[model samples]
Target: MEKRVHRPTAWHVTHWSSDPFSLGAYSALLPGGTPQHRTALGQVLHERLVIAGEACNAGAPAMTHGAWNDGLRAAEAALSAGARKVIVIGAGCAGLAAAQRLRAEGIDCTVLEARGRTGGRTHTVELGGVKADEGAAWLQHFAENPLAAVALQHGLACIETDFSCPLAAASDGDLPDVDAAWIALTKRLDRRLTLAEAINRYMVTLEPAHARATQFAIDANLVLEACLPVERLSVSALDEEGVGYGDRMLPGGYSELVDLLAKRLDIRLNTPVMRIDWSSTGVKVNDEVCDFCICTVPVGVLKALHFTPALPETQQQALAHLGMGKLEKVILQFDGRWWPYSRSGYLRWYDQPASWGEWLDLTDAVGKPTIAGLIAADAIERQFSGRTDEQIAMAATEALQAWAAAIRPTP
Candidate 1:
């Protein structure tokens, strides 16, 4: 068994999502907005400029296909304008998708990116000579997800995975005893969904004003995860749609997905958009102007970036009110699966039960011995803040050990 500690060398990323110009990898919405807001945001302004991203699609928001569809929708608006030339912003999945749609319609478009590469947040790195995804890992629920169809249409290969796991919660030493926790969590989730469904049915029978008042109650508890309370999410948030916990993984990585989507498009890289001057004749990037503009940048970036003619106070207020929280995942490698537990993918620990460091065991796709550790925002912040690699590894190992001990009895 060979144990190796992996660390980022020079921040090793080619995805423009992390670039200051882009601000975020993709769009995610918070609470307080209706489906109408999403529609209004995507509308083409006077056949000159339009906005598109995951946020535009109330049904498919926050997924790759959501952005893809949004791009096509925007391109259709541009194509109808009778404009020969158009400017596509951000070469991520959405931007590339828009450009492709416009090109197919025989419309001339130029893609501008802030970073030297495309595929916004979808990037990959060679870890132990195997591709590892740095962004957008899963094609959650491929049955209904449009990305799978798109990937297949583009001749990109995808790996269907059986992501079922032996455990669900945190572990102490090797793997935690998550039966009780799982049961509890499942019960709460089921109840929440049932309640939500009931509310939906009732809303159909109620008057408009009454239905609107009841929606707040239904939205509050649809999701089981406490970190992201479903109540604080948009009322139009999509249901689970039959994708639970884990699903298919892209072995070739998100970068491959991006590469597949970026075919036959004129993408200008390393040209960071400092300001979007939309008040004048058309949108301007780096002082260059164009006929029409399609913005695929994340909402966080839109809120952060300075807009010429200044964004309307209402839009600015919406941007400020609706925002995404921080999420981080830390991948840890092991010499051998010294997990000391007889489980496959997941572990749950509850030493203090603070929800600080919930982790999963990501082994090699071929069932070889390797580990990809995960930690979210609060958990990662609690333990990994300003820590060295060695320190992080030790801390992680110790946490795993405690988790395993909690779940299983000592021999």
Candidate 2:
């Protein structure tokens, strides 16, 4: 990997992993959605074949808590319908949660997981003896989030991170209070216009001279938080949804919740369900028959599975219209803390539009010299997908060094 140190700091990219199918990391409402339409999307089929997952949750889709809540809802429905034996496909957050609830209610159920391990998209990996999350890192709405309640109940280490740190520069004089400007623009954003149009108009109105640095900071914040460019996002949807504030991290890892939910459950690992035969009698998952079934697989994986009598036209249409946001993370380890440490658990760079600019510092939380950088936007994600880990790491290091240099004062 290409290494660049502004002041002789030591660090190395220890390990990294990419999830090609993590398209649903952040779900967006894209410009179209009514109450009736969202309700229809979450409907269960024939009372015996139920669908539950992050994508199936219309209220809060593309979130870990959403998946868990959906699983609980599905389990309740199945039990109320007199379902004694149920088959839950995919032992991810949703599947595990449903099974847990079912077991609590004295209902018989089995969880079939495609992968050998559980947690699904919430994967935690160890780098240089320190555990860090590879997927679904933070609790966006910690105070109000149910997952946070569970973590707190279990005595897991949780640290609150300030995501709204003021914009920084090499000299204090050059730094503008961009946070105030951004909040003002968001407050007055026209709901009718797309996010891209609204952002452009706001920039022209506020920064008539079009300062490149200010624009970069604005775009970087949007991409880092939303995981997609403003052009593809909807102003009304984003405003109404309002990406929850006050994020918190699990120092131990996000998989702790998974382990808690999967306790003593009948889980079959490395078992891929190829087909689901939901006939008039009951649901059959690749020869394993049950009174009811809760399919909580990812949207992409769900689309690939074969059905005996085919999915309903409405479901097919919903899947076709719904799209997943693309995102990837690059984790780096260093011999000791190199970057400036602060309670604000992140570092932002204005080098490139889609560079690995948003980095999460784990030094304070995990007490380790590790940081994970996020790469968002479709174009940059695809570009990184084609290159080697070394190339990506080198680019990230260069961008980080440039940012450090830009913010450091002259000796």
Candidate 3:
């Protein structure tokens, strides 16, 4: 590398995978699991208890809007179950959305959040003198997403983004055929296969250059989109999520929407429900009893929490089959815009141990010279193992410098 990347004045790093409240960045179905696993987890228990989240939403699992929709439906279902009072767990999108609906309906509801703040994974804090949504920032499938309109109502502007790959100058001419082969293989398969296995089996059949391209596509797109490492992702989920990118983001931060939905709702912060005891007529969340319970905690947290009398075998199996994505971020806020402003839209793909390959253009969102590198899938464990936050950030910065040197050479 000919050029050196300038040091940032400030930075932030996330460890959602290690956060006990989250236990993961989000949820993923295991290799052998199907959408039915989500259906099972979403199933209402004893007619008075329900588990809701993106993982429970089979239609759009592992998305903010999916979790939002899940909450709305969960509230309605709880009402139909003859519940007078409800206890919603987690303060994230789904729980807040559920509580919001209950508030509008004039129902008695209380939200228990383990964290001191609301917005669960949708956290936003000031960095570089601007707001940065630490967890989610995009409103994907905006045309039909309910939150898209709601964001405008909250006075949050929707910044339209280009999903088209901006990193590479030209599209791989052979890529479409390679993707088609992946689609065909996933669709025609009768058995279970991890994404890594499928990729390996398929890549072996391709020419050397095409095989390299295959890895690039997986690292550059699928892994980032899934927010999980290749080895843990299910082939079925890869097929189901298809190919989609966030077309818009809220420069004001996604937490604005969470706050809007949480308005006037009874939310108890720093309250964690370690055990949920439920029967035919009522549910006990820790020490408090409610007529109904909507457990919206992530699958990772749900797996660890205790349940009196035990959850049904089917639901237990569903929880076991569910996987969590190890999504971590390293954000660098430089004193000045030393990097190419034009390269903001151009994307880069990095392999494990390479550090900070997926650089996000936060130049517009953060209103400063900021770049966010995403570490997902198995790479997260590798990056975090025996490394401090400062060390991780430096490695990411070095990767950025290397990329800059490659793109803009110096004498």
**Candidate 1 overall lDDT versus native:** 0.59
What is the per-residue lDDT of model 1 for residues 5-98, given as tens digits with 9 covering 90 to 100?
3332212222232346544444444555555666667767767788788767766666677788899888888878776788888897789989
TM-score of each: 0.74, 0.86, 0.91
For residues 126-183, write the lDDT of model 2, one tens digit per residue. Answer: 7777779888888767777778888889999888777777224422235455566566
Candidate 3 C-alpha error for residue 239, in Å: 2.1
Candidate 3, residues 1-411, lDDT tens digits: the string is 534446778888888988989988888877677889998988888788889999998887877888999999999998888788999998888998899888888889999999999988888777768877778767878877888879877678887666554553112232233354445545544444556766677767777765555565566556766767666767666655622455687777887788787889899999988999885467889889999999999988898888877899989989887977778888788877676554335456444343454666788666787777777776766777888888888877876776665555466
| Candidate 3 structure, TM-score to reference | 0.91
Highest lDDT: which candidate? 3
Any runs in candidate 3 off by more than 4 Å, and if so which?
A: 169-194, 242-246, 342-346, 352-354
lDDT of each: 0.59, 0.70, 0.76
Candidate 2, lDDT over the whole model: 0.70
Clashes of each: 27, 0, 3
Clashes of 3: 3
Q: Candidate 2 — which residues are off by over 4 angstroms? A: 1-24, 31-38, 166-177, 184-190, 193-218, 240-245, 382-385, 409-411
Candidate 3 Cα lDDT to native: 0.76
